[model samples]
Target: MEKIVLATSQIENIAEILEPENKNIWAWIGKAKKMGLSDYALGILPKLRIHEENEMEGLWLSAEEPEYIAEILEMENNSISLGKVKILELCSHAVETLPKLKFHGEYVMERLGLEALFSEHTAEIPKIENNSIWIGKMKRLELHFYAIEILPKFRIHRENVMEELVLNADSPEHITKILEAKDKSIWIGRVRKVSPIEHAKRIKGKLDFTLITPDDQEENGGD
Candidate 1:
């Protein structure tokens, strides 16, 4: 029933400081698993540790023999440490991806601080065949599940005969919500935003369509 508090970064470091290298570490690890230390916890324990006073107590417990219980305690400590590291990594990644600015054209490149970098590129809010639409790109990863991340922000008119599809913008959750909705037609387009030409092809004929671009073109690609 000992109490231990540690920051995410401190977990793995504490584990290493406390245990360094002990071949019997696996025994403690197995016991911790039985005790219900999650996979994350087991991985990070090497870095996390108790305060100086707690360390002294831990040392005493380890030396006191009973051996098996000491092993269990060690495993538990490691498990907790590993868990913290995972939590920290996930948090860090989320923060990195969170949108900093509003997803609108008003901010332009200045909002994302990409004005100078993207100076050559123009931000066009493409008009899809169906005025109301969303889109994104699809990608697959080994460890992570497949998902779509929206590319460009665009809209389609409801009256358009051709449908417009964006790639990678929609999540399964979003699609589920759309399917459950009363107005299914209004929610037309790919779940995620993707390349304009590609999206136009997907929704072509399904609805009257056009890709909104800085340059204007006829429905049949005519001037």
Candidate 2:
């Protein structure tokens, strides 16, 4: 029921007590925003209390809480890539307020800002036109469970510059089709328990694959 008003000095003091190694969470959040790590920042945003008086204010539930959140709306509005923020929050009230960005595709293009290697919706992959510049520039691609179903929709031509692929799936069977679909060699950077590491390595036609196995988790002290 108590509100911790946020100021530069106050944030630093609290962050020192909460995260000794990191001086302030706001610093990290700002860097995350600049680095386009919206998902990571959003994961911590729900616990925040948006101070009615000051939207930029940071108010956590308590000092004892393991996680903290802050109101980042003002920061987001002032971001260098404001359009990118809108694309990430497509269904939110923030995006709905922008009349110029009414159409999804054009504003998505605006959000891309000529540097995006790839983009996707919640469950749908963006349709890549033949003239699109991302053809040979996309070096890394990650396909989640639902995205796997539409794998056949896009073509990974031999000319593609893709060097890394990450398959996110709970069951090995779901991604088995993905491996079989690709005839060319792709460096699989990581697989999220989609298959036995050895089996994935074997069928994938390459020996190199990275997965955080239980042993690796134990060694790293587990997250």
Candidate 3:
């Protein structure tokens, strides 16, 4: 176990000693500092030490590294101080391993919720294609339309409207005229396979559109 004395002033200096030649160790040190780890402790940390290994090997640390660090620090301090040290370590690991886990988890949960709703209702929802839209049946005579439309208003193609609208299988009159007018049967087939109401609810948020066109014109008038 490589050890360094952690005093308030020596924290930054200690971190400098552990800095890698290629990568900016300062950024990681800053992050550790933000998590309330002393600079000296961060310098000698197992994870940072692994960074000194071959570049191809990559730096890896276990989930318990922070807890271990906390334990060591507690022993060194001769007293227990309560704060976010443990939480920060766990969070850092989570942040390091998979940043998109939160988003992916939410998406999976939303899909499962929709599946449950469909099972309870015993109805198949109309699928929306083209514009990333869907129409589903929540109850008898009640239909829902959900979509993720990308727009500067120009991106809204005919496929968007055709796929997002759902129609009742038994009642042809309830079907939208636009979908009925389409030439391809396969496109219509895809729109008919929509997911249930619970899934549709995930789309309750607003559609965000990014402007690709530059706001300022150049001196030569080039785009």
Candidate 4:
């Protein structure tokens, strides 16, 4: 009987520790750490919503396991907060796997966040409506080696009211494919050509390339 009572008390204590409060996530993280709990254990708490810039910041600072953070953000319902969370420099895996999470409905994230998180891995992330821009919060990330894979995913090629992106490729063939596909859908800054002079000249005119085209290859291309 005494063991049962202690167990009941422990359950209540955990419930209080894992209570869903959007504002004090950082504080809870500190408390949970003191109690020798893994940062991810908090992720299983139902109704836990992290929907603020500060809360996102706290999670980034405290959580060591990014997969848990990915799961926590997946439960977020606020579009505005989701926008802030995705741009964070978590692992490529965390950002790439977000689209596969079971969201409440169609969760359209800000395109800029996608640009930052999935720079080269865009093809790996499942399709989501990525168009909104949260002004004054633009982030710039260097191109990953395989960023050229973005050529086949047309969603990122949509013309935005405001955009600033740059691509650098090792081969002219890779750069050509990206430039032709982008076709001025968004503002692409001067591409740093590393292949050779002649290869550079081939894409020079297309470098300032603008004109959106249907990604006819999207259906057949494998990510």
Give the winner by TM-score: 4
Which has the higher lDDT value, candidate number 1 or candidate number 3? 3
lDDT of each: 0.23, 0.29, 0.24, 0.32
lDDT of 1 by residue, 1-223 (tens): 3333323322455355345575354434422311222222323233333221111111001111122122333332112222101011111112111121112111111111111012111111121122322111111100011111112122322332222233221224312222332332333332121232322223223322244443433332211
TM-score winner, 1 or 4: 4
Tens-place lDDT per residue, model 3, 1-223, is 1212233334456555555662455334423322333323433443332221111111122221333233233332212211112111111221121111111111111010111111112111122123332212111112322111111111122222112322222322222222333232222211222322443233222222121224422121101
lDDT of 2 by residue, 19-44 (tens): 44543554344333222212223323
- Shift of residue 24 alpha carbon in model 3, Å: 40
In candidate 2, which residue ranges exceed 4 Å CA deviation?
1-136, 149-152, 155-160, 179-223
Instruction: Note the residue pairs that clash in candidate 2.
Output: none
lDDT of 4 by residue, 9-100 (tens): 12344455455554375344333211212334434333333333321221221233344345555643333233132233323333343332
Error of 2 at 131 (Å): 13
* Model with the higher TM-score, candidate 2 or 4: 4
CA lDDT for candidate 2: 0.29
Number of clashing pairs per prediction, in order:
53, 0, 6, 3
Models 1 onward score TM values of 0.20, 0.25, 0.15, 0.36
Q: Which ten residues in a row have the lowest lDDT in candidate 2?
A: 108-117
TM-score of 3: 0.15
Runs of candidate 3 with Cα error greater than 4 angstroms are 1-106, 109-167, 185-223
